[model samples]
Target: MSKIDEYIAKRSKQSADFAREYKEESQKLQVAVEVRNLREELGMSQRKFAELVGKPQSTIARIESGKMNVSINVLNEIAVATNQKLTVRFEPVTA
Candidate 1:
């Protein structure tokens, strides 16, 4: 294969990998929506929630926007801040 063709092929593979990773991450961010919902249900603003969680409000914003990576620890912190508990379930992806 020509150099340009090889580069294109490699770039396409990388893009595919990135897209798949992003999809998985975006799926995980569904939890962020839950966070927002629960917070709203409890009548808390973003800033207040951030203060309670000891995180920057921007961090909460980014998580709500699904534009940031949040770990289980951060989620737990958010839970505690909201006076809620965090739960995780691992189920195999059905084919």
Candidate 2:
């Protein structure tokens, strides 16, 4: 692995709290990216997407920025607004 990847692996292995927190943040980021990508793919601006979801532009910004602890309800709204399907899954954690 690269140096940064190696460091992250070491840190995650050495600290359960770190690993859990990192994984949580990573999941949030992935969701944020997916949301932003969906909006872009639909050729919708944040403000337009917010209107579709009945949220303010700032809320959409927060979700896209990964600064919000987004609710499943909000995610569902986004999925409906974007005409996309939402899926949730769990997998074994790897170090």
Candidate 3:
């Protein structure tokens, strides 16, 4: 491969890794905040909410504690069960 091609490949891999990590962290933070807000607003215990959502109590605890990587679908289920709004947003990067 050309030197420029190699350089581009290296940088692309680094950028991809950074983007993946950032998204994972962002999603986790979002879920944590949403779960806490919904629980408090409803005055519901973790176990109670878990039962309502059909998720494990420990999973709910982990999610609220920022120790779980929650998927968008799972979070949507939580939002639906709790009657709370869980909104996600993204903006294009500016050059």
Candidate 4:
């Protein structure tokens, strides 16, 4: 693994709270990346995307920056506005 990955893994093993917070932050980052990618794919600026999604520009900014704990309902709204489908599934956790 890369040095950063190794460090994160070691830290995660050493602290349950760290591991849990890491997972949460990682999930938020994943959502942020997805939202940003979709906006870019549609060739829309954040302001335009926000208008399309019927949310404020600041809300889109927060979502794309991983600074917000987005709700599934908001995600669904974004999917609908962007002409995309939203799917959620459960998978087994791995160490």
TM-score of the candidate numbered 4? Answer: 0.94
lDDT by residue (56-84, candidate 2, tens digit) is 99999998998888889999998887778
Poorly placed runs, candidate 2 (over 4 Å): none
Q: RMSD in angstroms, all models?
A: 7.7, 1.2, 7.8, 1.0
**Candidate 4: regions farther than 4 A off:** none
> What TM-scores do the predictions have?
0.71, 0.90, 0.66, 0.94
lDDT tens per residue, model 4, 5-85? 898899999999999999999999999999999999999999999999999999999999999999999999999998899
lDDT (Cα, tens digit) per residue for candidate 1, span 8-74: 5566577988657755675768967887887688788999888888999999899888787788999
Q: Least lDDT summed over 10 consecutive residues: which range in candidate 1?
A: 4-13
Which portions of model 3 miss their true places by more than 4 Å?
1-23, 92-95
Clashing pairs in 2: none
lDDT of each prediction vs. the true structure? 0.78, 0.88, 0.81, 0.96
> How does model 1 score by TM-score?
0.71
lDDT of 4 at 4: 89
Best candidate per TM-score, number? 4
